[model samples]
Target: MQLLYACVNVCVFLGGLAEEVDEKVLHAAFIPFGDITDIQIPLDYETEKHRGFAFIEFELAEVND
Candidate 1:
């Protein structure tokens, strides 16, 4: 069985403006992590900019091993 773990502390670059960052970009960046099961990028309600980071859920704990 594969043990799942959540990966955090992803660094995202703001494209020109802070508001340019979106979920789609975050998902694409993390796509290479084959064990990733899901991703969530939160945005500021007023600024609509990425919080500068995201939470990635990995399907396996030993992915980096």
Candidate 2:
């Protein structure tokens, strides 16, 4: 079977985050690194709050530097 993967830029995985952290906080904290394309924070269904982690996607792979 051929596996197809989507093209993605530099992505950062952050764990052990506080539930209070949100997209805005992440954007502000990471913007100095590079242009951020997206931020995803998974939430707990019961509390409707963040799951103590997030994914940050940068516009360019160079952000890995």
Candidate 3:
């Protein structure tokens, strides 16, 4: 599972998310690894809602590992 933590940028895909997931929740989850550069949660255009996936970018590249 450490391999999953080793990336400056990672795209997290959630499975069967019961509710809408926001950027704050994702940021908190990744903060332990390193500084967060940015977080993007793609939402549906028609419904204007989260798509159950997010992209997290860390400040340092080495933090990915």
Candidate 4:
């Protein structure tokens, strides 16, 4: 079986203030997922900050479950 898993990590600078988080912070949070094949974090070019979410791809279904 072929399976793909996507995960998102959000960081709130002031807790409940999602707008205050940075892209770097979000990226750092995702580091522990382990064996991630692909990662994408959309950000605002003007501010160069995280959109408060991320997308990660894992090739193995069993690893996620």
Candidate 5:
């Protein structure tokens, strides 16, 4: 019997980011590394601003290197 395996990519976390940073900024900064699947920056409802961190998902796991 043969088995197949599927690799899963992991999301990269960036902390200490400026509140002014947004999805666009993150994209521009990370796009050069590889194709980005998604970018998420959690925000505070009260201030309606980023929570000083962001998550970046690259299309390939190699980009993490």
Candidate 6:
């Protein structure tokens, strides 16, 4: 995860989310912060369920504090 973070300019870890949350919802929630380069919501391959958290990548390294 650190490698992925390093490769990206700016990133954030959003947690304590409900199980129903998906990538699009996460993206919408973070737009006010800055330009979103990527949004990842890991899924359970066996259960086909969202893991209840997300990783958001921003366009620049200074997008977040």
Highest lDDT against the true fold, candidate = 2
lDDT of 1 by residue, 1-65 (tens): 87233455342333342455566776676667655566666667798666665566656545573
Off by over 4 Å in 5: 1-8, 61-65
Estimate candidate 4's alpha-carbon lDDT, on a 0 to 1 scale. Answer: 0.52
Candidate number that wins on lDDT, 4 or 6: 6
Report, for every candidate in turn, its global Cα lDDT versus the true structure: 0.56, 0.83, 0.65, 0.52, 0.78, 0.77
- Which regions of candidate 6 are displaced past 4 Å? 1-7, 61-65
Q: What's the TM-score of each model vs. the native?
A: 0.46, 0.78, 0.63, 0.41, 0.74, 0.75
Candidate 2 regions exceeding 4 Å error are: 1-7, 61-65
Clashes of 5: 0
Writing each residue's lDDT as its tens digit, candidate 6 over 20-56 gives: 7888888787899989888877777888987776788
> Residue pairs in steric clash, candidate 5?
none
RMSD in angstroms, candidate 5?
A: 9.3
Query: Tens-digit lDDT track for model 5 on 1-65?
Result: 75222224657888999767889999999999988887878778899887888788878655353
How much does candidate 1 score in TM-score?
0.46
* Per-residue accuracy of model 3 over 1-65 as CA lDDT, tens digit each: 33323344554444444345687777777799887777767667898887666667767465454
Please report how far candidate 6 places residue 41 from its true position, in Å: 0.5
Output the better candidate (1/6) by lDDT.
6
Extract clashing residue pairs from model 4. Answer: none
lDDT tens readout by residue for model 4, 4-52: 3334433222233277555456556655755455555566689887565
Q: Tell me how candidate 3 scores on lDDT.
A: 0.65
> If the candidates were sorted by their TM-score against the true structure, best first, what order would they fall in?
2, 6, 5, 3, 1, 4
Q: Tens digits of per-residue lDDT for model 2 on 1-65?
A: 86322338888888999767889999999999998988888778898888888889889754353
Candidate that beats the other on TM-score, 3 or 5, i.e. the better one: 5
